[model samples]
Target: MAAKGLILLLFFSGLVSSNVEKTIFLAPEAREIAHDAVLLGRRLPVLTPSNWSLRTKIDAEFPTEGSSQGKVSWFFLDNLTEYQRYEVRICWAATQPTAFTLKTYEPSVAWEQPDLRASIERFVPNSQQQDIRTGVAEPTSDQPRISSALVLQVSAAADYFTKNATLMSNVPLVDVDVVLDPYILNVFPRSLLPNAACIVLVAIGSFFVSRWVIALIDGLLRADAALEKKQQ
Candidate 1:
């Protein structure tokens, strides 16, 4: 269903939409990344930028919905060549539980290369496997902008690498997995350092000013009373 929605979006827009005019709860860094993705989406021929919005459809993880597991995954197979290196980055919204897992799948021996029609089925997450590696957590939220990341070093087998040593060595692969919170992107940290310094100064100033104002008012009232008694 998620795939279908993405396809429909591509089809309707003809891959020429100016911007995805939608809001979601994303962390500051994630929000910036998302904006960059949208900008890239507007320019790129492929669907790298709009991937996060599509994943939000699966569950509630955007600005509107605050709960549930929202997921987004992308593959870089379309542009892969026999003598090329690749890097992939994946980002998603963070959820309440805060648990994250990453799984890596390698290509099979029978997977043929050099054929233009060849399909790369190398990235399939194993659902039956109980043990999935835990990802490193990078909390980006002060309130709810927390996110996580996992770096995946993807390459062909040793035999394949030996055969194409020149091709593999020339290019490096980088993959980024980020789960973001759309709501907390703009939330400021509530710490008592430099941020609180301004507030604290303002508070002290207000406190003295208020005290002086009240004292003046009280003094005026007492003076008025004394004048009234003298007249009496």
Candidate 2:
């Protein structure tokens, strides 16, 4: 009966341990920027004024489709005013026993337009420079024209089942190798190593406990036998 109770306790402990999940955040990459000038190189004759707009699509590396955490954004700078705006969209997923549901988050300010513009100007000042020459005079540089097209920011979360649990139906096992970022993982507590030394310590402790229990039982049995012999 004691052994059976111990086995049941161990089974419940295993079940609890197997349900742990690990979540990580992943940032999205900008594949290509959309704009009229980018499509038709600058060499093309300047035709009518260009009204530039762009769209980008993102997909998870694993599980192809469904809920995941990430952000998509569209960015543009008003060259005349030297101000920038990042229109962002964020989404995330929660997994259930039966299905996964995607939750979309409302877009909010990621960075101030003026601050973004200032940073860009400081890093790439020559980016705004242009070249011109005066007749019979030295050539002079002018501010380079900034592209109307903007690159959007994309961020997402990569989650994995760390515990020993069966995959749900229709859920694809993500096989992509992920190198965990040490900076982020440091925030979470990890399992201690189950080394040989620890195992030996546990075994020795169990052996002593079992011996003590068995000795008590054997003493009781002997007392009962001696009493019966005396009665006879």
Candidate closest to the true structure, highest TM-score? 2
Prediction 2 TM-score vs. true: 0.24
Every candidate's lDDT = 0.29, 0.31
Off by over 4 Å in 1: 1-192
Give lDDT: candidate 1, residue 192: 23
What is the alpha-carbon lDDT for the whole of candidate 2? Answer: 0.31
The C-alpha stretches of model 2 lying farther than 4 A from their native spots are: 1-199
What value does the lDDT take at residue 98 in candidate 2?
16
Compose the digit string of candidate 1's lDDT tens values, residues 85-167.
22232332222111222232221211222221121221223211311222222234433321121112122211113355664
Summarize candidate 2's per-residue lDDT along 1-232 as a digit string, tens digits.
9999999999877664322222332222222222332321221111111212212222222233442432221222121111222222222223312112222111112122454333323322221231111112211323333333222222223345444444322233221111111122333212223455588899999999999999999999999999999999
lDDT of 1 at 118: 28
